[model samples]
Target: MSSDEVTDVIDPRPARRLDVPFQGFVVDMVSDEVDLGEAGGIVRREYVDHPGAVVVVALNEDGDVLLLRQYRHPVGAFLWEAPAGLLDLDGEDPHVAAARELAEEADMNAASWDVLLDLLPTPGGSNEAVRVYLARDLTPVPDDERHTREAEEADMVVVPVPLEEAAALALAGRLHNAATIAGVLAAAIGRASAWETLRPVDSPWEYRKN
Candidate 1:
């Protein structure tokens, strides 16, 4: 069968979904702890609530992927990551939000996009679902329309890195951001397969295989 005719069969298995009640946030706390049962059951759990977010993996016509290096206050250092942000509480769609974040952080707009995957960022603690999108057919736009926190805070610099290099970075322990690494590698593999299918051949691989 042709590559296009190939189908991925997925096993349908449901996870044990937990319904946890939200508690109030702490303005200040010295230490908070959770107690788990001896049998690996949760007796108590404490965590800060967070909303879902979207991560964009944008690729330009040259096949380079866009990335951002920004300072994370919590980490106290700069980290490479894809353009992403929390969803708008007013019920903004995740795909639209991903596109918006791409433009806001990278100053580029995608003509085509596909949602690669959605995953729970921290299943153990929080329920923040991060949706990853693969963006293509990129075009530059005005920087003034981009989102900004403060004049100096959260400076977003758009960097175009080759997809191969990005994947190498991830494997070499450079790309530490979970969402970004996952999204980039997914897109890279997809693009590679697409390129392979489109390559010119005498017999065409599909017929040869058959």
Candidate 2:
């Protein structure tokens, strides 16, 4: 079999030049022209230029995972999802960002954190990558420390489901959010292995670096 027939963990892409076709408040549509070496020739592709994000799978001592139900306008549905937020602030650590999202979105904090998974939900269309975190030893934020809610978050609802049940929901397609599905399933699998698959919170994210 040729080398191209075998899938590898890392596939080095060709060189490319990028230009933005449309810029939104939070994201931009970018077009790139790739140099596919002398044999393949050049090709153009367009995709969303995302800022990346962190997702938190906050697990309680009772083995329940915290979730948020908020209206996602793009999907036109109120979906149950893990707490997540973008890495909008320049130079902000992803771990810190994940912690902040847990507090702001779920009014909770965790004493232990581990990297559960990293994923590109729409690799064919967008450069958006998300790191899912497993947070345990949970505690609620103080009333005064809670972030003021606005927009869709103003009506956001928090729910706690057993970790196994959440995994079932993901398999049944009841949980529509990408991060929540991936996080729940990954957490379930990791727990079965006594979390040996977990990575340190500070572990480098190669997708973000690229």
Candidate 3:
């Protein structure tokens, strides 16, 4: 095929009705039949219907990134991760969710924010889109105003790792959290480019919208 004819783009997904096989508290196992055009064919696919999420790569004046060591029951390990949360609240903006998670999980706030990266962590098995934000000019949340934690977050420990070191840890396969790895690497790239590639905090995210 000619280079001009080999362009990459998202073909319109075939219309399909989704049926829930198992509905859980926060997600559902959905099944659908998709038309893969003439060359391929129709195929049945099952995946987790996710509500999407946001991650905050909060950076201090020293360029160290805030991280939380939280116990993940599913993974059976404590992971060092950037402050993140699901977009479970009705009508909550992604940016607002990121800010809230930063304060709630990390006990901090950022004065500046920008879109660092967008990702589909498990495209083959889930439609879970994530938006990672670059948060700077950090300040601690007032003790009285701090959010009370529960469950997994109750014993979460806040830690600071330099952005460059975080990126290195990700490269070395030490950072296991998908969002944390992506966020720090993206932040490193953004910093190298003087953040010219960073998007506005309110940048349109069609993946989540759809």
Full-model lDDT, candidate 1 = 0.69
Mind giving the per-residue lDDT tens digits that candidate 1 earns over 86-108? Answer: 76455566667777788778888
- Which segments of candidate 2 are over 4 A away from where they belong? 1-18
Clashes of 2: 0
Error of 1 at 203 (Å): 36
- Model 1 error, position 53 (Å): 0.4
lDDT of 3 by residue, 1-210 (tens): 788898435566695867888999888899998998898799889999899999999999999999899999898999999999999877789999999999999999899999998998998999898999999999999999999999999999998899999999999999899888989998999999998989999897878833
Score candidate 2 by lDDT: 0.90
**Model 3 weakest lDDT span, ten residues long:** 6-15
Better of 1 and 3 by lDDT: 3
RMSD of 3: 2.1
Question: What order do candidates take by TM-score, descending?
Answer: 3, 2, 1
Model 3 spans > 4 angstroms off:
1-10
In order of appearance, the predictions have TM-scores of 0.70, 0.92, 0.93
For model 1, state the Cα shift of residue 152 in Å.
6.3
For model 3, which pairs clash?
none
